[model samples]
Target: MSRTVFCRKYQKEMEGLDFPPMPGAKGQDIFENVSRQAWEEWQNQQTMLINEKHLSLMDPNNRKYLQAQMERFFNNEPFDKAEGYVPPEK
Candidate 1:
């Protein structure tokens, strides 16, 4: 066997070994559980924000303004000539 392997096999007898703790010495999934929960919460908040923005963009008054703008352009009116259409509830 290689000298390094032989020496490590009896490393406890050397009296100067400084090996780190074996895996799971403190607890398993300590950092992993915390990180996973944080990531899931972040994803939920992002999804909620995205859904709110989508709903606002799809609102009726916003759609009306878009339609009016398109109509004005199709009728050959200058874009600036269309009346400023404010959102109904805003």
Candidate 2:
């Protein structure tokens, strides 16, 4: 059976990630607190931001910006979105 966590974003128990998404304390915290669904959603948003804003992960500043945005996303606070982005119709 999969583990369940009280997801920080969804605020209810849900399926948890099999492993930490990244290294270090933040990853551990997210593994403990964030649900798989929330993590996946964040990844989608992160991709959109990177593609739309032309953010390069190799740049330290860009990485920092993404980190801040990720924190805001998880906290349910206001976060930046890709300007003029429209989701593709299904």
Candidate 3:
């Protein structure tokens, strides 16, 4: 059976990630607290933000901005959305 966790974002028990998404304490915390679904959703949002805003990962400020957005996203706080973005029709 897969591991389960009290997902911080969903506020309920759910499937957990098999491994930390990154190294260090923060990654470990997320591994224990964040659900895999939440992480994947964040990845999609991050991509949209990066593309829409033309954010460069090489820039420390842009990275910081994404970090902050991630925190807010997990906390259920308001976060920046890519402007003028319309989801493709199925």
lDDT of 3 at 35: 94
- At residue 40, candidate 2 shows an lDDT of 98
Give the per-residue lDDT digits (tens) of candidate 1, residues 58-86: 67875465445433433445433323434
**Sort by TM-score, best first: what order?**
2, 3, 1
- lDDT of every predicted structure (CA atoms): 0.35, 0.95, 0.94
Q: Candidate 3, TM-score vs. the true structure?
A: 0.94
Error of 1 at 55 (Å): 10
Residue-wise C-alpha lDDT for candidate 3, range 1-90, written one tens digit per residue: 999989889999989999999899989989999998999999999999999999999999999999999999998999999999898999
TM-score each candidate: 0.26, 0.94, 0.94
Query: Highest lDDT: which candidate?
Result: 2
- Where does candidate 2 clash, by residue pair? none
Please report the TM-score between candidate 2 and the true structure.
Answer: 0.94
Off by over 4 Å in 1: 1-56, 80-90
Candidate 1: residue 60 lDDT (0-100):
85
RMSD of each: 25.6, 1.0, 1.0
Scored against the true structure, residue 27 in model 2 reaches a CA lDDT of 97
Per-residue alpha-carbon lDDT of candidate 2 for residues 1-90, written as tens digits (9 for 90 to 100): 999999999899999999999999999999999999999999999999999999999999999999999999988999999889888999
Q: What is the number of backbone collisions in each predicted candidate, taken in the order shown?
A: 0, 0, 0
